[model samples]
Target chain A: MTIKRKILAAILALALPLASPVLASEQAVTFVQNNVSKVLQVLSDPALGDVQKGKLFSEVITQVTDVDVIARFVLGQYAATASTPEFERFARVFRGYALGVYQSELSRFGNEVLEVQSVQERKPGDSVVLTRISGGALSKKSRDVKWRVITIKGTPRVVDIEISGVWLSQHQRAEITGIITKNGGQISAATKMLCSQSKTCTVTG
Target chain B: MALAGCVHPPWRAKSDPLEPMNRAVFAFNTVADKTVLKPIAKTYQTITPKPARKGVRNFLDNLQSPVVFVNDVLQGKPKRAAKTLARFAINTTVGVGGILDVAKAAGIEKHYEDLGQTLAHHGVPSGPYLVLPLFGPSNVRDLAGLGTELAVSPLSFTRFKGKQTFGRVRLALNTMDRRVETLQEMKTIRKNTLDEYVSIRSYYQQLRKDAIADGVVDMDELPDFDLIE
Candidate 1:
């Protein structure tokens, strides 16, 4: 290759990666912003029944959230030890539980609007997007909501959320691990308990 | 960066030196909650109508207003102190001894403050985290704060017949009220978390920090990051 071309290639290699993080950060912010707007719309739609709102919520949650990652993280040590089928079953139920949680919580803020405030890229692939929820009966002033987004295979997905300073996935990890430990380290026990509590999942034998 | 990845947050390591002892106490607390507290809270919920429950909570909250006001003054939050004072006066009178939250209806929202938050506002560091037998999660700083509050509690000094009995009843009702309010959340936590102790500790620390900042997230406390120019 020509000397000029070689130098140009070297500059491109350094600059391209540097530029990618900025782009990824913007992408993360936009991802959260759009999804949050969608959630607010679903919540406020007067014509939609509760079941319809729930269905839309589940769809958005499945698309925007990395439920597989969250399920594994909440499972903790058991994620590595459990059988593949067992892990999958747990993940399936976790999805329903997560959907239920998001739906119920968001329903309370039906009149609120969440506006993206700022974005901070922690690393090349991870970003924290801060948003504010205000103008609702529930939140008379405003509340801070932080979303941790991680790019997975070129698509940004939410990995965790910090609302009122409590990280959802971290809290879930503690809860799931506690249940598993309480029931003699049985994964099935945790699944059965969550199934009963959420009433959104079924434990199949 | 690699070292940072391995290093836990300051709150995780510095605040929880008594993990073993705390875990034991937490277990005892959990058993007590399951066997005694939960049952009582459930019964209370079952028997008490929603309005009655709200009245109980309001009355309890009104009783704590003096402590909250004092702490707000100590923390140099005059606005919050004034609000606390107003809530107390209004609720005690027009609300008929705090059975109704007239102050809240009049746009004066209730806020909580304690000596621990005052100490925090004054830059006192939260020391080791401890799980009390029935109290659940706390830290060294907060435990000291609790001690101070108890020592100077208005209820303790009230000159009235049956004051001692009232205090005991208040304590019992307070415990039951808290348990009742958090019953569903607690059940979900019990069924969900892998480490209840760690979860509760994290929650306690975050909540304390939030309370100290009056629900405002101190930007400095958040993980440092650079904004894209």
Candidate 2:
């Protein structure tokens, strides 16, 4: 092939893959533009209440999301050791837990805004990507809510969620695993405790 | 903060929690990457056209003196290649608009375009999505490529140059500019995507897998829809 053809081939080849994602987003973007406002309005309305917010959560974003997919990510390394029964039980417990987490999060979405601050960034292990999400919280006065979000595979599935400087998930995981290790070093008991960590967020899909 | 509430659907993440989104997002990302960003980058490349300066190549290549010097020491060709490219890139980038022409003129080119793109073209898959701070959309293998670039690139050797503050600043400025460009892209991207978190994760994985497969892994190319969450 000629130099031009090679260059063209290279360009087209790279172009094809990158473009597919960007263009596909156009439809997604259109959807957001059309529906995001209404969705936000419903979520933000004081009169809408938790019941209404819950409805919008499922009707809009939840429907499109495969929450089960996200739950698996949050489980992290534990998935490997989990038996079929353990895995199924954990998935069930965690799913409702995840939705409850998001619904409340979504209800409070525009209430307290995030202001960008300096970042403490590091790309973690090859399988998991860890980003220390730091920012200021804007309610009436601007206080900071510095947190770390570990995105596994692409989704910002919070692995070690931090509030201020406190590492919530890491501490929780350590405590549970520590207990399990203290007991008999079995993975199952530790996972059970981890599954029931947040009672409110625990749902069965 | 994973506050005090979460009621995710049953059987989420299939015991993994991150895999399903990883898969869905990759599937979504595959379409956008191939269909949009890649083409835009190409057009941008054509219209902007970078041409390398004469001695700039040697100066740039000479700057890679440490790269060749070290890689020869390290016994790894990929590291050596990365160091050479990053050094060239940092130089051209800091040399005013010197980058485009030089990259166009030859000292440095989009190596991923030449090698990675070809592999991707033949059906290679990107493994998973990764969201790097200040730099969006990369994967495990690519980041390793980047870490190697950062670790040994000749410009990084300037602190060792003993009397070259200007060279150090030039490299720093280049790094800063790249970070800024990436952040700008992320700001826009945060607003795009059908599912921001999911899309980003999935596409990144797809890209990584594609790179690893030496660029060939044929699979179902799912068409777009109104309900891709």
Cα lDDT tens digits for candidate 2, A1-205: 6999999999999899766554443333333334433544566667777767677666765533445554444444554565777667666655555555444433334443333343332332111111222222333343333323333344332233233222333223323333344345455554565455554534232
Off by over 4 Å in 1: A1-33, A39-59, A62-159, A169-205, B1-14, B224-229
Question: Which portions of model 2 show Cα errors greater than 4 Å?
Answer: A1-7, A13-43, A55-61, A103-108, A111-205, B1-229
> Which 10 consecutive residues of model 2 chain A have the lowest summed lDDT?
A125-134
Report candidate 1's fraction of native contacts: 0.23
In Å, candidate 2's interface RMSD is 15.9
**Tens-digit lDDT string for candidate 1 (B120-176):** 889999988889989989988999999989987776677998988988999999999
Q: Give Cα-based local distance difference scores for all models.
A: 0.80, 0.44
Q: After the best TM-score superposition of candidate 1, give how far the Cα of residue B9 lies from its true spot, in angstroms.
A: 17
Q: What's model 2's lDDT at A133?
A: 21
Q: Which candidate wins on TM-score?
A: 1
Instruction: DockQ for candidate 2, please give it.
Output: 0.02
